[model samples]
Target: MPDPIYVPVLKARQAELAALSEIQPATRKAILPVLEIAPSEVDDPQVVSDAVDRISKKLEVWGGNELIVDAGFLSAGIRLPSGQGATMYATAKARSLGIGAIPVARLSDGDSARADVRNLQVEYDCGVAVRLSMEDMDEDPEELDSSITALLGDVSVRRDQADLILDLASVQGDIAVRGGSRIVLDVLRELEKVEQWRRVIVTSGAFPVDLSSVVPWVQSEFQRYDAALWDAIRGRRRLPRIPIYGDYSVAFPLLVSGPPFAPAPQLRYTLGDRWLFLKGRKNDPRGSEQFYEVCEQVAMHSEFAGAALGTADARIASPREHGPGNGSTWRKIGTVHHLDFVVGRITTLGEP
Candidate 1:
């Protein structure tokens, strides 16, 4: 028998897990394909509007579902250095097309509009469902908690009302991948301490590692921690379901690409390590073609396809890959021409 005090928490977690199992399939169906526009594409008002129009049509062809437009690209536009202008534009455009648009904001990216309490207020007022990135704050749990609490306090909204995203790719350390699990668990624990914001989402970079590695590690950690907590309360050891309600998505950098069918190589390279090598046909410029192939492979292995792909048009601002094993020179990579292929693959994987 379990201690009466902790029995409620354990039962609640069990019920939540059971509910998740039933809705997992529908959750996959509601996945919002993300389209990242380049800074260059936002230079002209007409150009930005036209790009949004094209994206709307693409979403329709892809099954008329909602889309997630990364607002990071608006930072490059001449009229909208803050990126907010582009965000508003994308939101309005999606509404005009009779589809939903969710704008994602990275609070840490200097190029992205700073997500202060005031900005969040405006977002809330505009009826915009914004995704706030917490990658920069993962290193310090206390500070992360304060910032999140402050933000949520200002809005007075529940966790599910705010689309908070934790990017595991941004965690830094000697063994960053391994360390990422600890960082995520710590953050989740901190959030639970305050209030159980079960709807928080996780995302990962496409290169140097796969999101699959990070997601499973997180799930396992939650289960282990929950079990230990319950055992302490009940005076007996027993497994317990995870109590939180968050899920993870994958994001592929536009500049990074590889063969579609190739398995994700074990990503052992350290962050900031650069390298030059070819994984596909020699001289074949790596771009979106390879990205779609990789996303397809990832979806096939995971329980469901990712919630969204980080397609923001941005350069690999920092080094994410290591040099070739033999120590070779580096070269610049390019972008993918056909985002349609990427969307198609995601749609196929979302099917039953």
Candidate 2:
């Protein structure tokens, strides 16, 4: 049977409306980090933890679900309820204390500043940045070498603990491709799974989602997830380019600050142990052209702390290769331009 001439247009409009409809309810609501504005005198850990407990209880009463009571925000740039100042603490201390807030509002009041906040959240949430953190090496040169090695060891430790910490931060991990298989294709597949995973992340409260059902890569037998997620993604837009090569660009993925505030977690954590999935292609220097493009995309949009692609002569940070998925079995290995992308720099929430 022949379909109506307007069917395609109608279908497109329906998809647009569906995306918009998904936004309206929480569009105007501002989810801020519920914080404890403390006086400088109360820098004690026990004191802060107690205050965090109080704040958490209050937030629950006010319909808030998440809290980040970290000392980092004290020295970092965080606006207190007004006129209150304090010092930042270690993660142990920060975890003891509560930070962040969740404001349950019904609609946007059209305030320009609030609108700006929304924009910032969108930008920072997904924008990648070079993130730097100092670690104690050794006191002497001999010890310093070992110290640097020890510091690098922490990167692994942090990676291992990413899920737990990032979960508390309200961020999800993007699956990065690695290993001896068709790495690029594997990354694309993981990305598809990631997009599907995002629906579960943002709309989990409104809808139940099960990633395992949609993503063949995941094989857990006991994890129960919403099946409708696959349908939602299938109904959404698909990137025309799968093994997107050439001058293609993509939005730098971001990690959310925590639950009830951010959309998803950072790509680093999202990729997790799968970091080694891609095999590096050292023989072809031109092979890194695509990765360099990805790095440039991140640089244009993010505030990186110590990006390494600054030098063309640098070794491949995480080399990997792809094969067999698409036509032609080409072996190309390259490094992931080394850099630490900081997530949750987004100041505003709930905007396109």
The digit string of per-residue lDDT tens for model 1 on 1-352 reads 1101101000111212222222223332444344455444236766766665555454443233354456565544333333446655655566566555455544333322333323543553322223445446444666766665555554444454455555443322335544544545555565544343423444433233343444311121111122222122223223121322111111123333354343322111111122111222223365323433323332333332233322111112212333221101111111110121222332453211
On residues 213-279, what C-alpha lDDT tens digit does candidate 2 reach at each position?
Answer: 3221121221111112212222334432221001000111111132332111011110111121122
Clash pairs (backbone) in predicted model 1:
251-310, 260-293, 273-321, 274-323, 275-323, 288-336
Tell me the TM-score of model 1.
0.46
Rate residue 36 of model 2 by lDDT: 24
Q: lDDT of each model, Cα atoms only? A: 0.35, 0.21
Off by over 4 Å in 1: 1-30, 62-66, 76-84, 108-135, 152-157, 170-174, 192-198, 206-352
Question: Best candidate per TM-score, number?
Answer: 1
